[model samples]
Target: MTAMIKAHEIQGVIALENSFNRVGLDHVVLVKVATAGVVTRLMGGSREEVINALSNAWIDGQSLRTYRHAPNTGSRKSWAAGDATSRGVRLALIALKGEMGYPSALTARTWGFYDVLFRGNEFKFQRPYGSYVMENILFKISFPAEFHAQTAVECALQLHPRVKDRLEQIEKIEITTQESAIRIIDKKGPLYNPADRDHCIQYMTAIGLIFGELTAAHYEDSVAADPRIDVLRDKMTCIENPQYSRDYLDPSKRSISNAIQIFFKDGTSTERVEVEYPIGHRRRRKEGIPLLVKKFETNLARRFPAKQQKAVLDVFLDNRKLVGIPVNEFVDMFVI
Candidate 1:
């Protein structure tokens, strides 16, 4: 799909000015819209059919707010984007079979998506579609936590060595993050499962500080049963730092900064540690890419023999060999 359009098209969607989540909608609707247009065109649909397919994508998108946020964050948050993409492909397939589309699906009177879903405001764009999103994509490199809280986990890891020996002596812990982190992951109270724990900033920080590292297993029930985690969560306070919030959305400096400080029961405190951009941020690409490659190598090594792993890694490590390969052929390399 990316190969079919100019990078600007992807950039345009990334730069969308409106917050769909703010209005009780999942941003994955963009995925559906993009997929529908691309799939329809790939299926040799007429221009009108492509438009119709996109309109249907909008009309069918679920707000999906509860699955990700609110009092019941769950596993569905991980599946929602895939569901949207599947629906888009299905809609495109249906459109290819001569199905009629609602010409005014988005603009129709009171029943339109604008009036019904968007509270009467039409969709708005921040820039023309481009590949900026592809180029600056946030990689959830080491931690399995939410993207906004990744830096917080790094901060916790940095503070882990000093705080490990004084867990019970700690009085309170302070976490400062951008507004988006507060909005998406500043969770409190009981977290029921891995899905919930992974999204909770306090849980991630607490576990990182105590364990000296965090992994998928840390969010599991067995690991979460450690009473020390809940103890730390109870003593933690999270707040929005306006500067971090401002810098987070800055186009030139898309930093996901987080700060952590701890006060002991005694009259002592750890030096306030702050990390501006996570290792996954584009700004850290030089340092991050090697780690990403190592991560890929590690995962591949776990699944395949060294010989097979080397064969697979060779294809991915070489840009010249990978550039013009057919998509099907590339995927077939991993068929085993």
Candidate 2:
């Protein structure tokens, strides 16, 4: 767990200033690099072996960000991180088997990663990594929407009871959000599938406003077939609030803020509902952790019998016991 957290921090801190998207590369490249470096160390590889594994990861072809954007968005965006991590392990194993690595994989003038993938710019870091990323990780507790749209969905849910029965009377729904949400999730056209819908702020807000809740199932075609969702989506517009955008990038704040207001044709409007921090934000950890534990237990019940659930929960619920258990032993407990 500690090794994994370090890996996450390495990837996240590098990503803070490195705009891979601007160069058409996916952020999962960091996942592969970080994972290969740390997993090699965890496997008891020597310093040279770790360096070799990291070089292999850098030279491994990266996935294009195209699959995560409009016109090509699909399930590949969902599985890309897993694929990167798997490749990371493969590279680490190859290094352990004595494979030689290019010492200048990242800086080899003509054919290196910096020139070929990053537009000739070297990687940048905001800070030397430690546990910052793990300590400040955001969780998607109540909604399955994109992280940038999480607060947007919360705002919509807050206004749901007032607007659910007045769908026809609503003239427009204005969504005020951070620039990141606009850049990544503000969609104006037809969404082809669940992947597209989940990434669209308008579609996610529509679901929350109409149903008073947003869930993974809500993104399915069966529920999406409901014409009312599109009706609300068609009446929606998203605008960026500069302050929200600034706060989103502020390391001290790291907020994903959003506000929603519904205007009725008759001139009355729902009070603007704003959510600065999501339920799963670190700022709300006191209120969020219990819900997170409940969610975990509920998920466990879906896959395990009652006795098995209790057995697993016994160790998991006890922090000392959970952390003290050997990795292999802990993994074996879930094998059944």
lDDT of 2 by residue, 1-336 (tens): 889798989899988888788888899999999989999999999999999999999998899988777877798989999999999999999999999888999998989999888888898777887899999999888888899999989898889889889999999999999987988888887888889888899999999999999989999999999999898889998888999999998888899999999999999999988999999999999999999999989999899889989989999999999989999889887876
- Candidate whose TM-score is highest: 2
lDDT of 2 at 59: 93
Model 1, residue pairs in steric clash: 7-130, 7-131, 8-129, 8-130, 9-129, 9-130, 10-130, 11-130, 12-129, 12-130
Native-to-model Cα distance after best TM-score fit, residue 275 in candidate 1, in Å: 1.0
lDDT of 1 at 270: 96
List ranges where model 2 is wrong by over 4 Å: none
In candidate 2, list every pair of residues with a backbone clash: none
Superposition TM-score, candidate 1 onto the true structure: 0.94
Q: Model 1: C-alpha RMSD to truth?
A: 2.0
